[model samples]
Target: MFINSKGYYIPTKRVDNNYFAKLNDLSEDWYFKRTGILTRARASEEETINYMSIKAVENAIKNLPYDIHEVDLIVFASYTPNDTVGTTAHIIQKEFNINNAKAFYISSACSSAINGMEIINSFFKSKISSKALLICADRNSSYSDDRDTQSGHLWGDAAVALFFSSEPIRPNEASILDINTLGLGNVGHGPQAVTMEPKNGLHMPYGKDVFTHACVYLARLTDTIIKKNGYSISDLTYFIGHQANKRILNNVCHELGLAENKSLSNVEELGNTGCASAPLVFAQNYDIFKEGDLVCLSVFGGGYSCGTCLIKFN
Candidate 1:
C-alpha cells in the first residue's frame, strides 16, 4: 500500500502554552519546555468530528486524479466520536456520496490511525478493497476537564486524511513496508496510567509513570520492529512517533542513538491530537524525505498498545 495524497484540517481556534501556564500557575518556560508545545488548535462548537473528517478527505482527494467514486473504503480513527450510534466513517461515506464503499471506526485512542493503516494494507492485499481513505481525527477539546489540567494542556483538536491504494497510485509515494502492533494491557501500572470515565467523562493520567513507561516501551517497540525486519536504527531516515510530547520523542531518539532532526515532531504547534498526531506530522513532513528513504512510524497509546511501521519511500 502506498499513500497517493494527504489532507489535513486544522481547527480555527488556538491555545498557546501561556494559556495553560497561567491556568496551572506554572512558568511559561516550564510548560513549553516540558511539553514541547507552543500552541494547540481547538475545535469550535461548529467543528464536529464527522465534519472535519469529511473535510480532510475532501482535501486529500482535491489535488489527486481520482474521483470520489473511486474510493471504495474509509477507515475513521478517533476517540472523540460525537454520537455512539452514528459511525463517523459511514457518515463520511454518505457525505462524499461514496455509495459503494463501506466505512467503519477504530477506537484505539492515539494508535487508531496507525492501526487503521495496518488494517487497510491487509484489506488491499487481500482484495477486500482498494483505494481506501484513512482519516484520523480527534476533537479532544470537547472532552477536556476543568480539573485535569495536565491532559487539558497536552491534547488538541485536528484531523488528517490519507489516500491509500494497493496499486501504486503515484510514482512518488511511501509504500507500506511493514506494520507490527502489540497490546500490553495496563502493564501492571494499573488503570492510573491512563483512564477516561464514562460517567463524568474525565481523562486522568499519571504523568510521571506515564512519562517513564511511554519512553521505555515506545523505544523497545521501535527497536523490536527495526530488528525483526532486519533493519537497524541507522537504516531509518526518519522516525515518526506519536506526537504526544517533545520530551518523549527526544528521549526515545536519544535511546536509539537517532538524531533528533531525523524524527518528525509537530507537537510544538499541534499538541497531541491523539491518533491524528503521527499521521498529521508524517504528512506535513513528508517532503523532507528523499525517494527510497527508510522511515519508521511508531505510536504508543492509552491502552498500553504500541506499534511500529517500516516504510520505504517509492
Candidate 2:
C-alpha cells in the first residue's frame, strides 16, 4: 500500500486571537495546547476538489513500481464533491489517463476513506481487482463561514490518495487486517438524520449531543474491534483517530487506556479535513512507521459513521 497527501495551500483570511477573545471563547494558546494544532491549510477559490484530488493522486503514484495505467480500479471517497452527479473518480482517471481502470465513489462523511479501504480489500480478496487507488478529497472550507467561529475553526480542505495492491511484496511492513463499522440509529429514521434546510443549508448535529454520542460509540466500538482481532491494546503502537475534537479524542483515549501521544492527531494543524484526515496522518507520518509495526485507525464522524481498521506496514 502507498499513501500520500497534498495541499498545505494557505487561506486568505487571517483571524487574530483578540477576535476570538471577544466571543468569550478559548485563546489561541488554549486551542493549540488542547488540540495540538498550530495552523491548518485552506484552499484558495481557484483550488477545486478536482484540482486537489488530481495533485494528490499524482503525488501518490510517484516512485511506484507500476505506472498509473496499471491500476485496475479507483475508489474515490468524499462528502464534498465538485458536483453531486459527477464522480470525482472519473475526473481523476481522465487526468491520469488511466482509461482501463474502473471508477467508483463513496460518500460516507468522515469515515469515507476507511470505507474505501474496506472496499478495496474486498475487491482484492474476491479477485475483482489487483490494484486499487483510494483517493479521499474534501473541500469543507467551502461550507464553513468565517463569522461562525465554532464551525469555521473546525474545518480545513485537503486531498489524499492511497494505492493498495493484492500482490504480496517483500519487506512486508503493514497490511490491512480487517475493518468493522457501525452507524448510529436507523439510516433513514434517526433523529440525527441528515436533512436539507433552506437557510441552514444542511442540518443534523446539535454540537454537544453529537460529541457525547461520538465519544460513547467510538470508545466501545474501538475496544470491541481490538479484542475481536485477537490483539491486545499493547500490540498497537499507534492509534490514528479522526481529527474531530480534542475533547472527544481525549475521552476515547482515556477509555482505551492509551497514551495521548500514541493517538496521532492533526486536528490542531489541519482542523478537520473530513474524509482526508485519517489517511493524511498516515501520509505525513509514513516515515515513522517500521516493518511489522501495527497501526490501528479509528474514524468517527458526520454520517454518524464509525470505523476501525488494523494495518501493518511492509
Candidate 3:
C-alpha cells in the first residue's frame, strides 16, 4: 500500500525579492530560476501540525477503498511536533478511531518518513504487523523567522500519509526495492539548537553551505544506491528529490546525467515541506505511474542526514 498525500495548502502572499535583497543580498529571480520555486504554503498561526495531519489523513482515508480500522500500526514522522512530551500518532489514532494499532513517531530531519518506511518494511517482514499507516507532516512556517529571507522563503507547511499492508491480498503496482541512509553527524553536526527569539524567532540557516552539501551528498549517495541495487540511471522513470531548492535539484540531475523532467518537484508550489515533499510528489503523480516503471527518491536535510530509495511500480 502507498501513502497518498492530500489536502494541499500553501500561503498566498508572495514574499518579494526585495525582502531577500535587503536581508541577504539575494533576489527573487535567484530563488526562482535556481530552485524552480516561486512560492510556498504557510500554515496559519491558528493551525497546528496535529490539525494538518488529521485533515490530511482524513482526506487520504476518504480516498482509500478500505476501512481505517484495518490498519495495524500508525507511524507519524516529523521534526516539528505539536508538543515535545507526547507522540502525535496517538492523537491521529484517536481521531481515526484506530484503537487496535500500535502508534509511534520518528524524527530524522527531512528524511523521517523514508526512514519510517524502512522501519515499516522491517515490521511487516518480521510479521510484527500486517499493515501500517505512515504520515509525514511539518509546519516549518511556525518555526521560521519572517525577517530571515533565506529560511523564510524556503520553508513551507504540509502533511502527507501512506498506507502499507503486508498481505498479498491485492497485488501492488509498485514495491519498495531498497532504502538506504547515511548520517552527516561528523560533517553538518545536525540541528544542535531550536530556539524562537522574542524578536526574530528562528535562526537563519547558512544557505550556501547547506545547498552545497545537499547537492554533493545526494549525488554521491544516489549513485551508490543505483549501483548497489544493480540498476543504472536508465532504469529510473523519475527521480523525486526533496524540494529544498531548485538549484540543488538541477545540479544533482546534471551530475547524474538525468533529464530535467525525470525529476518531480513541488518546491515552487509548496516550498520545503520537509519529509513530506518527496511523498507528496509521488502522491500527486501516482496516477501516471505504470507497472515496471522505476522511481528513485533522494532526500538530504536538517539532521545533516541523507537517504535514497528505489521503488518499482507494478
Q: Which candidate number has the best lDDT?
A: 1
Q: Give the Cα lDDT of each candidate.
A: 0.82, 0.73, 0.77
Greater lDDT among 1 and 2 belongs to 1
Give a tens-digit lDDT track for model 1, residues 98-169.
Answer: 888978888776778878988898899899998898889988877776346667788888999998889886
Give RMSD to native, each candidate.
1.7, 3.3, 2.9
List ranges where model 3 is wrong by over 4 Å. Answer: 1-27, 188-201
The worst-scoring run of ten residues by lDDT in candidate 1 lies at: 184-193
Q: For residue 75, give model 3's deviation from the true position in Å.
A: 1.0
Indicate the TM-score of model 1: 0.94
Q: Model 2 clash pairs? A: 37-268, 37-269, 172-314, 173-312, 173-313, 173-314, 174-312, 174-313, 174-314, 175-312
For each candidate, give its TM-score against the true structure: 0.94, 0.87, 0.88
lDDT of 3 by residue, 1-314 (tens): 34322333333444444565567776667767755767677787666888888877876776665778888899998877777557779888988899789899888888787888888888988988877888888888777766665566677788888777765444553677788887786675345322344555555456666787889888888888888889999887999998898888999999999999999888877778888888888877888888888898899866578888888776
